[model samples]
Each structure stands twice: as structure tokens, then as C-alpha cells.
Target: MFSCLKHKVGEVLLPGDEFSFQPEDTISLTDTVKPEKVICGPGLRRSGDRLLVSKSGVLRTKQPNMFWVDSQQKRYVPAKGETVIGIVTVKSGDVFKVDCGGSEQASLSYLAFEGATKRNRPNVQVGDLVFSQFVIANKDMEPELVCVDSSGRANGMGVFGGGGLLFRVSLGLIRRLLAPQSPLRAELQQLFPHELVIGMNGRLWVKASSVQQTLIIANLLESCENMTAEQRRQLFRRAAQGAL
Candidate 1:
């Protein structure tokens, strides 16, 4: 068995593997093994007697690779049933425009707001934070968000005022943190007393006691990927207790 030390072909060295190259000797893996046999890296070719490698990062064989990171700051991906927090951007008759951190804005109907059909539609003005879900995302990836409940009831959903902080963050960081089952959620419940979080792929809206506390929560969410599970729990606990 040949052991590849590194991903590069030239860096690969076997126990007793030996090959000779003359003044202008060009040797390629294809000469000895079939193209299918060659693996790791990309763009393998034979030029004269020398094997040339292309800079393109493609491997002939299927190999586990790292996930792709977006060049932009961390953002959130709209999941089918994901519960998201958003801010009202516009109100037009029965519908409102919301910024969900994507190229296309989201649409929220007045019926989705709490008490829309009741006595009178609560004034959900611009900059009001709302907790909603991804109801529909078209084939073009345009999302239509909603705040209505399963029975089409509007409760525990709508614009949040007071005791909340809003800010922007990379979408990548949001996915790293904020799990439904994570201790952070419970800890936050105790910290803010009454908190609402809206995570857009590019931004975040949080409501907490103080700006300092909100910043701590944001830092914890951003560092979730680097902290251990135990550490994360501890961090959440401390933040809840106002230690962080």
C-alpha cells in the first residue's frame, strides 16, 4: 500500500517507491497507472517526460474536504421551517416588507401579526423586531416569511418593543451557535427575562437588559464553533448570571 504523506503528488513518498528522472525526464502517474488510479489534488497531466499539476483544487478521487466558507461575513440560510427574527421594513395594506438578510426581502401579511384580525391591527411600524418562520422560498430562492402559528393564529409573534437590542453579524457565526436544545437558549431566557432574537444571514436582533449584556451574548454566539460543549454551557450560565 502506498501512503500519501500530503495532498500533493510530489509530496507523496512510499516505503520503497523509487522513480528516476533524466535531464528532461517527464513521468506522469498516467504512464504507470490509469488516470482513475491517480488521486489527490487536481489537474494531473503529462508534458513531455515531466508531470505537470494544475493550480485548480480538484482531486481525481473522492476525498473528504473542508466545507466552503463564504467570503462575506457569516450569514443565515433560510430553512424551510426555521424560526427567524426579522424587522419590519415596510407596511402596505395587508402585507409588510421585511429584511431577512438576503438579496430579496421577505413578505409578511398583516394576518401574521398578532391581533391583526382582532379589535384592531397593532401598529407594527418600521424597525419593529418580529419573530417569524420561513413559510415559502420560491424556485428562485426568494423567501416569503410569516409570523402566523400552525393553526394560523397570531400569538407570541409580532413586533417586539423594549428590553431588546439589535445588531449586525456575519451569517456564518449564527449557524455555529443558537441550537434549539442548547443550554444557551435557556440561559438567555433567564438573562434577558424576556428576550427575542432574530437572526438574518447577515444581521442579528437581540433584546436584553443592557448593551453590555447584549454584546456578551453576541460574542458567545459568534464563538460557539470554537468553544467545547461544556465550555459553551458554562459560558451561557455565566452570561445568564451576568458574569460574562
Candidate 2:
């Protein structure tokens, strides 16, 4: 049965829910008879042309047929190339062990920083917040972090907090914030002149002009994890008016 979707958009889906493809509705190309494509995102799996929901959450879709479940989760699973906010937990001879809310502590190399070398190493200490990207991550191996990009540039991937506030949000919201052309960013930008470090690991660092403003920003964002887009817009508008 490759022609039936169990749940519509915005419906909360449970694990084991199955969706099938509808050939007539999905295939409209007259030039060639191509089978309808179903792109299964996170929380979904494909087994023999059957779409299986693997998480309990609302199902969402984007333009051009991308589907994913919007699950509220706090735990983080390390993935390569995902930038995250990490706390330095241990400093080894050559690497720093960082707690990034994952199954295991991630490792950051001492030489990962820009302009760092044997003669001049970055002065990193335990308990400091580091905004790093995963360079090596796998299910079977320990995760490794780096502060620089492919060109050896730090690119805002280094020490994260300097007297700022660090907080946690659901991993799904973090992904929503990092999404390209996200409306949340636009709304937040209009609220305050602040700096935000969004980590894939559910940690966020925010800095505003003053302590009160910073707290307001932090609380506002944390509250957005469960709000709809319209709700967030209304809250942001009211908060901005109140702040100013």
C-alpha cells in the first residue's frame, strides 16, 4: 500500500503510525511516469515503501515534499558538522572533554582554535562554555569537536560565554531556530539587539544590552519552545513594546 498517508499535516502522530503514497495525487508529470517520492525526515523511517513514524509528535511538511515530526525533546544526539554549545569538563594532554548534553562527553582538540599552535595555545579552562562543531561523530566512536571550519577559521565557533546567560531548550526548537528563512529569527531580531549562539545540542547563549534585557530575552525564547508561530509573534510584539 504505497498510496495512503495516515495523518494529515498538524496532526499529532504516534510511533508505529504508517503512511502510504498515493500515486494518482503525487504523480502529475506528463513527460515521464515517475513514482511519487516521499522524503522521510527525522523521526520517520522507510521500510519497503512504507513510511513509519518513529516518534510521538506533530507531523509537519515544507514546500516540495519534505516531511518530519516535530517532537519536543531535550536530549541531544551528536552528529558531525552540527555546532553546539559545550561545557569543558576535563582538560587532557591534547584534548578537552566537553559535556554537550549527549550520551558521552565530546572531545575538543587544543589546536582546533584559529591561530593556535604548539607555541601558542588557546587558554581554555574547565567549566568554560565552548561553541564548537562536531568534526567526528559516529554511533560506535567518541565524538570529536573543533572550533574552526574547513579553512581553519574560527567562524564564531570557539569560546561561547563571557558573562552571558546559558540556557537549554528542546532540540526541535533549536532546529527550528536554525532553519533557513525562519520566522523566529526575524521576530526576535525586531525585539532586541542581542547576540544568540544556537547550539544543536539544545543549549543557547544569549547576550543583551543589560541584565534585565538579557533575562527577558532568555525567558522569552525558552517560552517559545511550545508556542505556535502566531503565538510567538504576538508574544514578541508585546514583549518588544514592553521592553522599549
Best by lDDT: 2
Models 1 onward score TM values of 0.55, 0.85
Q: Give the C-alpha miss distance for residue 146 in model 1, angstroms.
A: 1.8
Residue 48 error for model 1, in Å? 37
- Candidate 1 per-residue lDDT over residues 1-244, each given as its tens digit: 1123123333422223332224324656565643223222323444444444433332233344221112224445566676677778998888888887666788887777555674577678888877788888654766877778778776566666576566665554454345456455555566565454655454566555677766776676666646677887777777667676
**Which parts of model 2 have CA positions greater than 4 angstroms off?**
1-9, 20-37, 62-65
- What is candidate 2's lDDT per residue for 1-244, written digit by digit as tens? 3234424778889999887654465655677885566677778898875688999998888766678888988889898889999999998999999999999998898999999999899999999999999989998999999999999999988985887899998988898899999999888898879999998999988999899889998999889888888898888988978943
Each model's Cα RMSD? 11.0, 3.3
Relative to the true structure, how large is the alpha-carbon lDDT of every model? 0.58, 0.86
Task: Output the TM-score of candidate 2.
Answer: 0.85
C-alpha positional error of residue 141 in candidate 2 after TM-score superposition, expressed in Å = 1.4
Best-fitting candidate, measured by TM-score?
Answer: 2
Q: How many steric clashes does model 1 contain?
A: 14
